[model samples]
Target: MAFSDLDFLEENFIHYAKENTQSNYANKDQVPTTPGQVKMMQELAKQVQDYGVKSRYNEKTAFAIGCLPANTAGVSPIGFFAHVDTVEYDDRFPIRPQVHRNYQGEKIILDEANGVFLDPAEFPDLRNLQGQTLISSDGKTVLGTDDKAGVVSLLAALKYLHEHPEIAHGDLYVAFGPDEEIGLGGQRFDPADFPGVEFAYTLDNGRPGDFEYETFNATAADLTIKGTVVHPGEAYGLMVNATTIMTEFLAALPADQVPEKSRGHDGFIMVTDAQSSVDRAHVGLIIRDFDWDKFLAKEDLVKNLVDRLGQKYGPDRFDLRLRRQYENIYNGVKDRPYVVNLALDSYKKAGLTPRVQTFRGGTDGNFITKKGIPTPNLFNGGGNYHGRYEYVTVEQMDKLTEVLVTIAAEHARQSQTGRDERPLKKYW
Candidate 1:
């Protein structure tokens, strides 16, 4: 499935993902900044300049540095972004990557001593990559390709256009941010600093063909309950076990609809944290769903459960707390169908059929949309993201780069027509 003369893209992409050394690498006992984050920004910025792309970079900032290409007469410049920080995982030192050389569709042996295998039963899509290359972990830690695949794809696209100057397109603004795992990516971003980026996408989705415009309407609910503590032998109704009450709250939650049990747009509630003692107890959970109405309903439902528990036990004797987190980003982009069409058209140009599914959780794209960047998300074919089981196809990474570049080119082509004038080959 490799494209003609596309070996360089695959070779360099795999090397970049492997060779990257940032806050996640094995440089010291304590996690140290590996310069991989900084290195990735510099490398891509360099490629932007070398490709005759007008771009910029930001250093000495927690948001790290970035570049947005200028939109010239024939070029439509857009930004593509991904994070450099990886989720905290077991592998904190020198890493090990298992590259399946021409995957044959069998169980992948990841750390044989530990019996770590990529079970197809667990990941049914392994059948889709019968002859493609895959990079996986040794089962001792995460694969880090969740976003590194994104970074590689952006760079590979630039390298492609750099070698072939006649591609004819608009500008590109590429970004590599830190702390996306910790959720600080858009906190320090100032879109005004990089101009002409009307719309953007984060190369942070799953499954190569996936195109995302919506993410979970996310929020959190925190609670607390109180009870009396007394000697067991002397205790009667005076001894109200706080832990027992906490268990009641947990038991009251709906079954068959949790993060692990749900799929697609199905929302669920899960207790992410809990603590208890005889005198008092505390609990917390995330309320996740794609629809905003359901999101609020879910939030109110958790609070209602807490209120009912307190009334049953006497309001003054027990306590409760609840809070909401971020909202669904669909409304921000829903009105702008062109943003979606932009993404879908790019996928089609890259030979991907373009599958659109709402994200089960929030992403930097949602935050950016709220911040006025109007961004959607693009997938890199990685599954089991944010965990040790993460894996992605090398072939998908190749297509992603092409998609990024082709989108910019296609937009530029459509720009001159101005809708009233005419249209590009398909748009017209």
Candidate 2:
């Protein structure tokens, strides 16, 4: 009684997972930052057409856009986003996906030589995946399940809808984006591609029932400290050590408000990287919070710290640049509760108990929501994302497909009758 083809999900996930589409931050200036992503996006543009979707590859935006026209009227266009790019991994070994059929919750060895094994005891979630077809990496490289599972699930849904013409639905827009791992993909998304689309969902990493509307309101900051360097023998009063200023700035930061200390609804300011020398110093940090006021406060704390240092030294010596990365999806969806209610209702119809939680990290939905579309995140059904331990189950992908199909059909029905307008609960 599966909604879509499980074989299709399994076959396609493995095929796409084998390709190295790891995004790079260093070459982020490029549209996709890597050639492999373009190859996959372009292929996807052509592949989706086989499912009766009108597709195109937008080189400017690096998004493979596909549209399945509505069979019924009155329902507004909705979009689904799945990034083709994955987090960077070692390239020495190609990604080789290992399929374990009818998994019995045993300790599955990925590579005995490397002592790499996925134990159900260590990952208790694997125990829930018993009797399911589990897919994982060969311990040499990533399986790219962070989103390949999402991509295939969307495809399976699209294929199922195409085959069953009797199913009523509205225009279904799908965008396979590039460079999401580096946080550049969604920023480059052109809303024009999904014309008239009011809302969207990003199928990113999570368990099957996971639904996230509130995500981190993120901001990145770069600080540069300038110092006057003098010869050590004559440095008595002339030498101003930049490293010392950087140390003071770092110490001034709220030590309690860090990633390890902060969890659940709490936010954190994390110093990602830092380098210092007597002559000059540079520090890179990022701020994140689910609450808008708290998010801004974190940014202000950094700015105030720099201002105090400037007062002690000289105003010209301390230069800090703060940039907003993305805002919480709650900001965009709060007024329009239907967007969330529709997904939750559809989840119930798909036999899933909606587990709404505040996302600790940001996704493509964050940027898309800021672009006038109230975008939230739906689970792609996987664990250990962005690493060798990453894995996904075929049944989980099938469940995601079922949820998507139900959402489309339910959306059409709701539009004709009445829309769900239930208010979203504050998870914090």
Best by lDDT: 2
Q: Could you tell me which 10 consecutive residues in candidate 1 have the lowest summed lDDT?
A: 419-428
lDDT of 1 by residue, 184-257 (tens): 55555667654777778888858877877777887777677778889999898779888998998899999876
TM-scores, all candidates, are 0.83, 0.98
lDDT of 2 by residue, 85-154 (tens): 9888889999999999999999999999989999987889898988899999998788999899999999
Q: What is the C-alpha lDDT of each candidate?
A: 0.71, 0.93
Residue ranges of candidate 1 with Cα displaced over 4 Å: 1-7, 19-49, 53-61, 64-71, 74-77, 118-124, 232-240, 311-323, 384-389, 418-428
Backbone collisions counted per model: 12, 0
Off by over 4 Å in 2: none
